[model samples]
Target: MTDVEALRQQVAGLMPKVRQDLERLVRIPSISAAGYDAEPVRTSAEATAEILNDAGLAARVIDGEGGHPAVIGSISAPDGAPMVLLYAHHDVQPTGPEELWSTPPFEPTERDGRLFARGAADDKAGVMVHAAAIRAWDGRPPVGVSVFIEGEEEAGSEHLPDLLARYADHLRADAVILADSTNWRVGQPALTTSLRGLVGCTIEVRTLDHAVHSGMYGGPIPDALTALCRTLAALHDERGTVAVPGLKSEPSDPLDLQEDEFRAWAGVRPGVEMIGEGGLTERLWTKPAAYVLAIDAPRTKEAPGQLVPSVRATVGLRVAPGDSAADAVGALVDHLKASVPWGAELTVLDSFSGEPYRV
Candidate 1:
């Protein structure tokens, strides 16, 4: 039989064991986000290392600066062959509420030819795909294989750079396959060519030293909350397109999503017009803009019928591909400071920024 056919047979034979392995992994609640216990993350990393070792690779668990563990494994290739890196994460996102799940989040259950579990579809499945592929070749594929299963991806990948730098020599490869992203749809494959970067900051507006009765100072003096809202409104024009200056936007790829499909997917109510001034793909994928993430203001129940003295809001900006996140953040800060209404005092505090990737 040809190499391809031989590998296919081997994979078919390993399906049962693969399912068992995946179920074992899905049982671990390896949530690496804030407020979750860290022990399961380490346990998941150890389990991943063991799986890699079973596939004949020399596997080890390494901890990055964030103290989250990562599993690394490798197998040598035949002479004159290329080296390939397979990347996935071992940690899973938090199960929002147990009551929402029909079955326990950690218990792997199968229904309608699908496995149900917190990490079954996300990343633990990805880990099994790699393991099964390696096992098909008996851990001796034609091309070199390097496996990197990270633990902090769901937590924003804050320490990914540090981990990469620390293991540069071992993780080096001519090509990489990131198995975290979704396929276009089931049974269809797609290659993601571009992704937008992110930058965020908190803007605090102060117009008075203390609150005053609205009846006394409402007409002449604009409240800090009002000034902040006006400043935010200026970031988007009537068309809902971002109006921030010095931000970058680029022409999008040819692929487009139909308006009806988008509406159904986004759950837009009927008769509500969509905002933005360009093709949906370009506006979403290759654009720089602002979004209000959270606002710090009193609720209606807590209102004191007084003029607000200060307001704070967290704003997030998505930097388009081919643009630098640092530059985008700088421009956004300048825009917010210059846009404050009625000479209100403004302070912009940066939270975090991530560089965009195009691959």
Candidate 2:
């Protein structure tokens, strides 16, 4: 029988080293967002390879075709044991406006018994967890362990299929455990059972041939910004439930989650009623949601008193499970086209989609 107490103590003893290794990874600024430097991502991949190797896995850094570097590491299991694939991504989302951060985005800081930094938990933490498990076993885990640390998950895992195809043999396993996700709350463990697929596109709304003085065109003629805003507003109904037709929603299993507890946990402000027409868990897990992720227009301070000729927005939609990415994206595009006001010109570009998955 496994000695649970001994294992717990052994893990507790090595936490400092784990923290140090995680801090090293967090300092690398491996932002995989487009237009950022690529070198840091490669550096981060190499660092991940080193961490796995030091933990007794035979690891190396490899690049995906036309994509960023990824780290693959593995240790063989004892005879008759099963192979397990462990997954985590080293690449992090671009840190928008570092000025908003409490400390340097790459500098690991500890306060109130928590560490702060970009990628601190969003997966450098997961990577370290896997490493810690290996070390706790004294580098010989009971099952075969294969580690896959992709470098561009934040940038949308564009080449994951290629990588998987290339390394099919190395990654074969009886089970796969993704070292990622959020806990229910502090001291409460929760396994994430599903993730809604992602779909989105950049939409441009053009109202006029060229920019004109807003004072002259204000009442008589419409501006692209107003048209864009109106179109986006059409995405939801009176109850704030998604207004788009053809998008899917399914009833989720009930849980003991009350509105007050949800508000307290989610930081819902006073009098700000939550949107969506369903149980909170269903709305979050099974129903589709729409969001305006970003917009292209003049900055507020730099705005001129002119009727903008064109405006663009990135509309993102969470696709519910059992729905195809193709169908979800097609539905979104069709709705956006049908919803545009006053016959303003519309064009969609940079469409992207990821299929919803369950295991």
Candidate 3:
């Protein structure tokens, strides 16, 4: 048989084992977000290292400056051969509202030719794909292989630069396969050419030193929450394009998503009009602008009938490729300051920002 046929046969034979391995990994609640225990994160890293070891690479867990653990492994190739780096993350997002899930988020369930669980597709599957490729070659591929499974991608990858610096020599390779993106379709493979970088900040608007009764202060004085809302609403224009000046954008390659498919993928509610003016892909992939991630205002259930004294909100800015994250962040802060109503006291807190990258 030809090498292609032999490889296909090997992959076919490995499917059952791969499924079991994925199930075992999906069982771990390795949430690296705040408020979750760190033990599960470490345990998941250890398990990933063991998988790498089974794939015939010398694997071990390494801790970064942030204290989260990561798995690294390597198998050297013959002289003059190229080296390849495989990248994935093992940590998962917090399973929000367990009641919404058909099965327990930690328990893997198979139905309709799909596996349902947190991290199943997002990255645990990525780890398994790397392992399967290594096993297909009997743990000895013609080219060098290095595995880097990170543990804190869901948490903004806060310390990734430090981790990369610390392990610079070991992680270096001619090419890197970041197995964290989506395929074009179920049967189609795709390579992501570019990614937008992110910058964000939390702004606190303080209209009053303390809450005042709304009945007495309602008409002439605007509450801090209302002021914050108005400022946020001003971020986009009538056509829903971002109004922030000084932000940068570039021309993107033409690729269109049909509106029906987009609505299905985005879960947009019926009767809701799509925002922003431009080609859909251009607006999504090439734009730099504002997005409110979270607000720290009081919940409706817990809120009193008094005027809000202060409101804090986290605003995320997606920097276009070729734009500087720091400059984008400065423009965001400037826009928020310029848009504040009634000269309300504003304090902008800087959060982590990532530089935009192109491949």
The TM-score values for the models, in the order shown, are: 0.88, 0.94, 0.95
Residues 1-359 of candidate 1: C-alpha lDDT, one tens digit per residue = 35778777899999999999999999999999999999999999999999889977889999987668999989876898889999999999999989999999999999978899999989998999899888988888889999999999899888888989989989999999888776654556677778899998898999999999999888998899999999899878898888878888899865646888778867999999988877878887898767999989878899998999999999999999999988988888888888998999999755678888898
lDDT of 3 at 321: 93
The TM-score of candidate 3 is 0.95
Best by lDDT: 2
By lDDT, is 1 or 2 better?
2
What candidate 3 gets wrong by more than 4 Å, as runs, is: none
The residue pairs that clash in candidate 2, if any, are none
Clashing pairs in 1: none
Q: Supply every candidate's count of residue pairs whose N, Cα or C atoms clash at under 3 angstroms.
A: 0, 0, 0
lDDT of 2: 0.92
Task: Give the lDDT of residue 211 in candidate 2.
Answer: 96
- lDDT, each prediction: 0.89, 0.92, 0.89
Single out the weakest 10-residue window by summed lDDT for candidate 3: 182-191
Descending-TM-score candidate ranking = 3, 2, 1
